[model samples]
Target chain A: MRFINVIKVALRALRRSAMRSILTALGIIIGVAAVIAMVSIGNGAKSQVEASIASLGQNIISVYPGSATTGGMHGGWGSASSLTVDEALTIRREISGIVAVSPEMRDRQQVLANGLNWNSSVNGEDVTYLDIRLWTIAEGEMFTEGDVNSAAKVCVIGQTVVAKLFPDGDPVGRSLRIRNLPFKIVGVLKAKGFNYFGSDQDDVVIIPYTSHLKRIARRPNLNSIIIQAESPDQMTRIQQDVTDFLQQRRNGRDPDFTVRNQQELAEAATATTKTMTVLLGAIAGVSLIVGGIGIMNIMLVSVTERTREIGIRLAVGAHGRDVLTQFLVEAIILSVMGGTLGILLGVGSSQLISRLNGWPVLVSTSAIVGAVAFSAAIGVFFGFYPARKAAQLDPIEALRYE
Target chain B: MSHVVQLEDIHKTYESGEVPVLAVRGVTLTITGGEFVAIMGASGSGKSTLMNLLGCLDRPTRGRYLLGGTDVSNLDRNELADLRNQKLGFIFQGFNLLSRTTALENVELPMLYGRRHFSTREIRERARQSLDIVGLSNRADHFPSQLSGGQQQRVAIARALINEPQILLADEPTGNLDSKTSVEIMGVFQKLNAQGITIVMVTHELDIAHYCKRNLIMRDGRLVSDTPVVDRLVATEQMQRIVTAETDAKLIA
Candidate 1:
């Protein structure tokens, strides 16, 4: 019954000063909305990273040449003297825990189909490269292992390159020119969209690894070695095995080689996303603290304005605790109302982002509950001083107050 | 046999900077059940302070204050609040009706804070009864600001009477009214007092004090005189004649 009267008084006072109450609530609204929006964007970025890492295939490992820069013509070396084709063959034959191996060679070159010509990365790797990297042909067929062995002049074109170079035909089995060397298009690769840096992935051509090493650049060393483990659990052991194998092959000769596992790459990306999420959330939380301060200021003013009213109630039989409860209820109502509105706006904004930019967004139940609870806590914490001040007022002085 | 209020050697001193300003000093008084008493003093004569002490709104700095056999001056804050809720009702000089509340709700305020529960209909009915006692039943829905000073004072009187307190304490209850409104408010008080309700009014007007059966005049926070009015100024019959005469004048106009 006492609580009901407190709410009644709060509602009455709020109605009396509608504009001030709404303005006070606006602070809470902004605070809650900021928290939710920041968290959602954080979650969205995280999921985007996870999707990118997932596309890279969890079973694969990547190896790149050391320094591709030693004594260059301009920007260092054209390619390193490390990672020969012999090493790739040796890893394939000797590494016990390794399930598959694919050596990759890539260079930026101009490729032409009919009259259309564009500069794009032309990657040279075998059939196992596609299997280990989880790349699938969306049309026609892949180059055979025989084609790889023979350094066949056949290629798989990416979606963007296909669209740009062959707008009017299938281009499959059609011959394309890679800087004066002709290669038939064996397949059209599926669209991989963007990488972590928002760079286009569907702009490369894939050809036999030996074709680029022998016929294209005529280089003896490898740029990168890609491998796949039998299972995700064997990734660490397989990484060690491959490292040891390379070291032994080089006669413990400071091989200057590094092996990156899929798990480590995923962990690094997740940690980065988590850090970004916390930083954004902390920035938003500062606004909530400011909003709480606003509540405290307004509550103190309200207590002063209602001092005589408090006295009247006290003289008419309201306890000091009743006065405290009434003002506290008002503060709570303001914060909870603001929190509810902010959650709605935040969720709506996240959905808008997802729709506009095709970014992944998720609004978790915990964030909603957490925002509401945090707003309520702000109300109680900030409302206490004012409520206590009002409650401790001398009734005689308060009654005499103008 | 029982007194509604009793004060023995009450003294209240307020500090103004370093010196203590005596607001009420060495005062003793008593109001038995069913008595109408008026406290009279000049401005700053400590009449308001005396009323506050009588209404249980403030404690005397040093004194024994008993309300209906209970020593109220020694009571704690909560106890005083409970005592005020149960035993005392107040009508102030400014009426002091809660501005936003309707006349009926204002009358019901004391009951709302009481320990008992009343249904909405019951509360409304009781408030209506109190308003009817003050002849403002038709204006139960009117807000304090909407009413005339006399009507507002009557509404305040209704609020004071709703709790059926052991004593009705009125502090300068007619100070804000014109002569005619003052007479009307005093008539209402007289009617309530005739129903055997104890009334203690603090006022400065001689005419207002003359309406009470007993009068106490204060000087420098001390009661200088306590005497019964040999012939009450309004005297019931003369006030009725004047009211009828005014109605006739209004009709003539």
Candidate 2:
């Protein structure tokens, strides 16, 4: 028989049992839809995490002092005063890949400005702090290195502080009192949203470490140092250089500081999300296999039910190959049609979910194409046996079937 | 006259579980072109098996069977199918018209599998002509379920004739119909035979066998008798007599 005529006959046969065909296709529909939806949701979450990690800082490394131990009572990391402002400057000058470095000291302090009082974290850092943290001054210029050298009482306030203390007016060029000492606001930092730990990132004030030691906290050995590499590719090299330099400075006495890079943190976080994505994709894949089995089951039933029709076709001169092609084509048409509908449903539902839950979801084009192709493969894989059964039937016996 | 079918000592055996049953044992026959012949037998006398062999629906287990000069007894399944498509048409006891299909589409079915490529337009035109030959052109759009038994049989005949086969093989074509409808269906066969189409039909009814020009009787898996009908019954005349008798009985009642 001509290929088109065989296809026509298959379609006509399927149309004769439209409701049954649809019911048979439903399994594939749900399977493909689940695969698409699950994969999209997983990819969305992974990318969201990556974006958040990117926002933290690029190629950043933090060096914190080892824990303080007094009389065998040990405090946690960054409790000892091992790192100093001199070491921070020396590393910045000596390291090849180092772009900037800052010594950091943090304390919670009450601030008074414009007849309002707010309690916010006060951070003492050098001029390189902004560069290492990838923070920008949105309102006014940053305090210069000269200001740090002079122990100038100048500060950069974050957006959360601005919203709290300077709600009615701009804080730049204005003085705010921290711990009863007045400090002039040099810049207002741009708003940085919440971190992965759900803490407000824009709830702090930054002042020169020298100024902080002289005017606010009084005595402070450097708590930690933040370093920035020239590029992300140079992070590990710079980290190793810093570690060796710090070890030499400490006389290699069991390492008094810990050097941690932002890449490590990002990799750890992304690993978890990647595992989750694969898990979801695998679960969805199981459903697809189940759907393939369902197709096989229905196709077997269809072959049995159409025995007489197959006999009639054979009697009218249809070859066994023609009958086989007809049934196989029917199965393929069902799966492909189901796959198309599933893709539409998946995309539509993903969009609906994004709208309702405010979650990011990415419907990849490759995924859609892969799903359609896979379903077609499933049709072929599952449709073969039943079609062969129909083809091998004895026409005389089939015609005589009641 | 060239013979359309020549069976040389054909034998068919059935392997039923542990027992082998001989269905047709050494049946030899020859049917020429344009001859209307009927094979008659009891239920287990192997007449149906002979029809199956003649239709190329089954390969003879032993002996030579030639259809239109092609030795078909040893042909493979696909070749036999091609022979059936190109050389023979089949009409079943139950008018095997596809139920949901229109009569026109049912008639177009055989052409769909024809060896010659037929365009859709040509297929439709030829199907209409075949239906016209069966006097079913007006009922072309009706489905088999919607048609009467005789109309369905006529549609099946149209389907059979669409391929322009050399021979028509009908197995109990009127077994499901009333006697009046049987005569009406036989009239269609006679008309096709008069147009030079060879026909081989199977029936148990002796009266039905008398409608053909020749009768072959089978018994115990063998051909017991093969004879030309001395006084063949004309299907149209018999149909007219049946109608008249029915009308007179209705008038008397």
Candidate 3:
């Protein structure tokens, strides 16, 4: 028989049992939809983590002090301050890939402004701190190098500190008392909502490190050093160079500092999300196989039910291949149609979820196409056995079947 | 007349289970074009097996069977299907018209698988003409379920004739119809045979067999008798007589 006629006949046969065909295709629809939704969710989570990391700073590397051991009682990292201001300046001048470096000292202090006292962490660093941390001034200006040279008591307040200390007016150029000493607020920092650890990022105050060392928290050793690479691609090399330089400066006695970069954080976050996506995709793939089995079951029953019809077709001059093509086409049509509907459902549901829950979802075109092709392949794989069984039927026996 | 079908020492055995039963035991038969012949036997006498072999639906276990001067006893499944399509038409006892299909489409089915490529318009026109030949042109759009038994049988005949085969093979063609409807069906067969189409029919009813020009009797899987009908019954005349008798009885009541 001609190919067109075979398709027409297959369509007619499917139409004869439209309900069964739709039911058989439902399994595939759910499977494909689940896969698409889960994958999009995974992609969304990965991008969300990347965006958070980007907000923290670009190509940032932080150096923490080494651990301390007194009388065999070992202290964890950052227990003793081994880094100093001179070392931070040396890294800035000597490292070829280093763009900016700042010595950091931290302390919690109570500040009184407009008769409201608020307790917030006071971060002290040089003017390079703004560049290394990618923090911008929202109101006035950052504390300049001249302020650090003379140990001037000028500060930059973050959004949370301003909200608590000066609720109705701008805090720039306003006088605030910290540790019974009067300080002038030079700027208000821009808002950065939260970090990956759910801590408020804009809840601190920044001051000149020279002022911090002379008056606020008289310390000889620095807490940590923050460095920024010239570009994102140079981060790993810069980190290695910094590590080697620190080891040499410390006489290579098990290096007193540890270097960490944003790339490692991003990679760790991405790996977790990717693992979840693959796990969800694998679970959905099982449903697709189950859907294929459903198709096989329905096709087998169809072949048995239409045995006499097949016999009549054979008696009238239809080849076995013709019968095989007819059933195979039916199976393919069912699965392809289901796959198309599944894509629509998946996209719509993903959008709905993102909108309702305020989560990110990315629906890639390649994933949609791959899902459709996979379903079509599944149709062929599962449809083969039933079609072959129908084709191999003996016409005489089939015709004689009641 | 040219010989359209020739069988020599044909045998068929059925190995349904452990015991082997011979359905047709070494029977030789020859049928010529334009001849209307009927094979009559009781059930289990191998008349159906003979019809199957003649239709090329089943191959004979022994001997040669030639169709239209071509040896076809050993043809493969596909070749046999082609031969059946090109040279033979079959009418089953059950009026085996596809239930959900209209009369016209049912008649168009055979040509869909025919060797010659026919356009849709030509197929439709030829199917209409075949239905007209069986006096079913008015019911072309009706499904088999909507038609009476006799009408359904007529549609089956139209389907059988749509391919324009040289020979028509019928297995108990009127077995499901009333006596009057059976006579009407027989009249249609006779009309086709009179138009120079050879027909081989299987019927156990003697009255139905007498409508043909010749009769072959089978006993124990063998052709025990072959003779020309001494008093052939014309189906049209028999149908007219039945109608008149029913009318006369109704008037007497």
Better of 1 and 3 by lDDT: 3
In candidate 3, what are the lDDT values of residues B91-134, reduced to their tens digit? 88976666577899888888877777888899999999999999
Off by over 4 Å in 1: A38-62, A66-78, A89-101, A107-122, A126-134, A140-155, A164-187, A193-200, A208-221, A227-248, A252-290, A353-358, A362-375, B15-17, B235-253
Clashing pairs in 3: none
Model 2, span B1-253: residue lDDT tens: 7988899999999986688889999999999998999999999999999998899898788999988887888888888888888788899898877768889999998788777788889999999999999999999999899999999999999998888899999999999999888999999999999989999999999999998999999998999999998889999889778878988889534
> What DockQ results for candidate 3?
0.50
lDDT of 1 by residue, A250-365 (tens): 78676556777778878888999999989978987887777767766765666555777777878887788877777778878887888889899989998897779898887867
State candidate 2's DockQ.
0.72
TM-score of chain A of 2: 0.85
> Could you say which candidate leads in lDDT?
2
Q: Candidate 3, residue B251: CA error in Å?
A: 14
lDDT of each: 0.82, 0.86, 0.84
| Model 2: lDDT of residue A280 | 82
Across residues B101-188, which tens digit of lDDT does each residue of candidate 1 receive? Answer: 7788888887777777777688778899999999999999887788999999999898888888999999999899987788888888
RMSD of every candidate to native, in Å, equals 4.8, 3.1, 4.0
Q: Number of the top candidate by DockQ?
A: 2
